[model samples]
Structure formats: structure tokens, C-alpha cells
Target chain A: MIRHVAVFRFVPEFTTEHREHWMALVRALPDRIPQLRSMTVGADVLRGPASYELAIVADFDDLDGLEAYTRHPAHAEVLRISAPVKASLATVDFEIPDAS
Target chain B: MIRHVAVFRFVPEFTTEHREHWMALVRALPDRIPQLRSMTVGADVLRGPASYELAIVADFDDLDGLEAYTRHPAHAEVLRISAPVKASLATVDFEIPDAS
Candidate 1:
């Protein structure tokens, strides 16, 4: 399986409502995108000096499924909404061995 | 629960064996550290331009639990082994609300 993680650090001015707005879109994703096997969106509770405000961790069957989920319209809309508020974005897409 | 993720990009000279060497210690973590509720260590299958070579995704009951895991002797040994091979490390620690 492929694990795709994307984390976003919001602009200093972004508010809780703005974060919830993005999270709502993320929460609604599994139903909208057929390739999304599992997804979790969470806010950072331990806001240390290096903390990121929001993160999304999702799994896909393979690279193709991950690509499809990225290209979905809902994802596009999320990108559009996040453009103004995002300060930094970090992501990783990697494959894991099949469970024995 | 608190989610703690750590990703490592190894030096160009690091080999699969070095990765496995580290992973072996990681795989042995939950047994050594009672606070580590769940842990997954995997090599990156996707070698994209921005790929990180190894990653550890682990969950803890709370911030204190996460801290204890980090301070565990086995974990410290893993860190010692990784020092020579590690190129870059990126980590994120955050709290997620109860799954209702």
C-alpha cells in the first residue's frame, strides 16, 4: 500500500474557522474519491516551536490510486481554498511492504 | 491520542542494509517501550524528487506517552545508529480528538 501524508502550516492570520473549512473538505474526501481507502485530518494539539497546524494522512492501494485521488475535483477545490492561507506545505508519498 | 511521525532521508552512501539495520530496531520498539501503542516502519517505494528514504509512524496514548517512547533506551539506540546515515529528518507531533 501507499501512504500519502500532506501537512500544511497556515498563515499567521488564519483562524479556527478557516482550518475547520479545510478539514471539512478533507473529512468529506473518502466518500467523494473512490481511491481513498482511509483518511484522517487532525489539528496539532502539541504546538511546539516546530509544529504544523494541520495534517492529512491517507492510504491508497497503489501509486495509481494515489495519483487519481490527487487529481480528483474535490482535491483541486481544496488546493484552491488553501492557496491563500497556506504558509508551508510538506508531503511524502511512499510504499510499504504487504502485511504478512 | 497523539500521532508522532518521523521521516528520514539518508546520505547517498546509505544502503538497504543500513535501512534494515535501523528498521530492525524500530520493529523491536513496541515490545521494548510499553508507551508505543502502534508503530510502522517502512522504506519508501516511491523515489520521487522529494522522497524521504525511511519513515516511522507511531501512535501514543498522550503527550507523556510519546515523550516516554522518545526517551526509551531502545529508541536512543536507534537514534545512535541513524546518526551516521541520516541526511535529513522531518517530524510532526500532534493531538487528534477522540474518534467518535
Candidate 2:
């Protein structure tokens, strides 16, 4: 499996309602994007100095599955909402070895 | 459960050996730190414009367990190895709702 992890810091002007709407869209992605094997989306509970505002961890069978999800219209919709309000974003894509 | 996710960008000077040694230590953390329920560490497969070089996703029973893992000597040891070589680090701690 491949894991895709993204952390986001929202712009200071992004309101509670905006966050709720964005998070809802992200949480609904697996249902809309068939390539997602599993996904978890959450708001950061600890607003520490190094903390980002939100995170999503999603799993795919392979890079092709991940690419499919990335190009899916549902994901683009979420990204459209995110792009304007995001202060910064960082992502990591990595392979997950099967259990020994 | 609480999920702690961290993304790191290593300094330009950090070499392959440094990464392997650091990864070995981090992969050994779950065994050394009993507070960790589960952990996954990986080097980034896609070095995209917004990519971070490494990422870790770990789960704990609660904030207390997370705190214990953060304060553990073994974790400190890993930090010592990571601190100087890490150009940037970002973290998010959030609640993972139980599956319905």
C-alpha cells in the first residue's frame, strides 16, 4: 500500500464555518473517490508551536490508485476550497510494507 | 485514540547514512516506548515541490499516552539524532474517532 499524508495550516482569516465545510468535503472523499482504500481526516487538537491546523492520512493500493484519487473531480473540488485559505501545505507519499 | 503525525525535511548536508541510521532508530521506537499503540515511518517516495522528506504517523490511547511517548527517553534519543539534521519539522496531534 501507499500512504499519502498531508498537513495544512490555514490562513488566519479562515473562519470556523470555512473549516467545517472544508473538513466535511475532505472526510467525504473516500465515498466519492473509488481509489481510496482508507482515509482519516482530523482537526489538530493540540495547537502547539509546531502544530499544523489539520491533517489527512489516506491509503491506496499503489501509485496509480493514488493518482486516480488525486485527479478525481471530488478531490479537485476540495483543493479549490483549500487553495485560497491555506497558509501552507506539506505532503508526503510513501510505501507501506506489508506486515512481516 | 490520538494520532500524532510528523513531517520532516532534512538539511541539505544530511546524507544517506544519516537517514538510514535515523530511520532505524525511529522504526525501533514502538518497541522502546510502550505508550505507542502503533507507528509507521517512511521516506517520501515523491519529492514533489510541496513534499517533505520523511513522515511518521503514530497512534496512542489518549493524550496521556501521547505525552508519555513524547517525554520518553527513547524518543529523546531519536530527537537528538534528528534535531541538527532536520531543516524543518511539522506536527499535528488529533483525535481519531472510533469507527461506526
DockQ top scorer: 2
Best by TM-score: 2
What residue runs in model 2 are displaced by over 4 Å at the alpha carbon? none
**Residue-level error in angstroms, candidate 2, position B86:** 1.1
The true-versus-predicted C-alpha distance at residue A95 of model 1, in Å, is: 2.5
For model 1 chain B, where is the 10-residue window of minimal lDDT?
B44-53
- CAPRI classification of candidate 1: acceptable
Alpha carbon lDDT of residue B54, candidate 1?
78
Expressed as tens digits, the lDDT of each residue in B1-100 for candidate 1 is: 8888766778878788877877878888999999998887788776665566777778899999999987889889988988887777666786666681
Q: What is the TM-score of chain B alone in each candidate?
A: 0.92, 0.94
Going through the candidates in order, the fraction of native interface contacts each one reproduces equals 0.32, 0.76
TM-score of candidate 1 chain A against the true chain A: 0.93
Candidate 1 lDDT at A79 equals: 81
* Candidate 1: residue A16 Cα off by (Å): 3.1
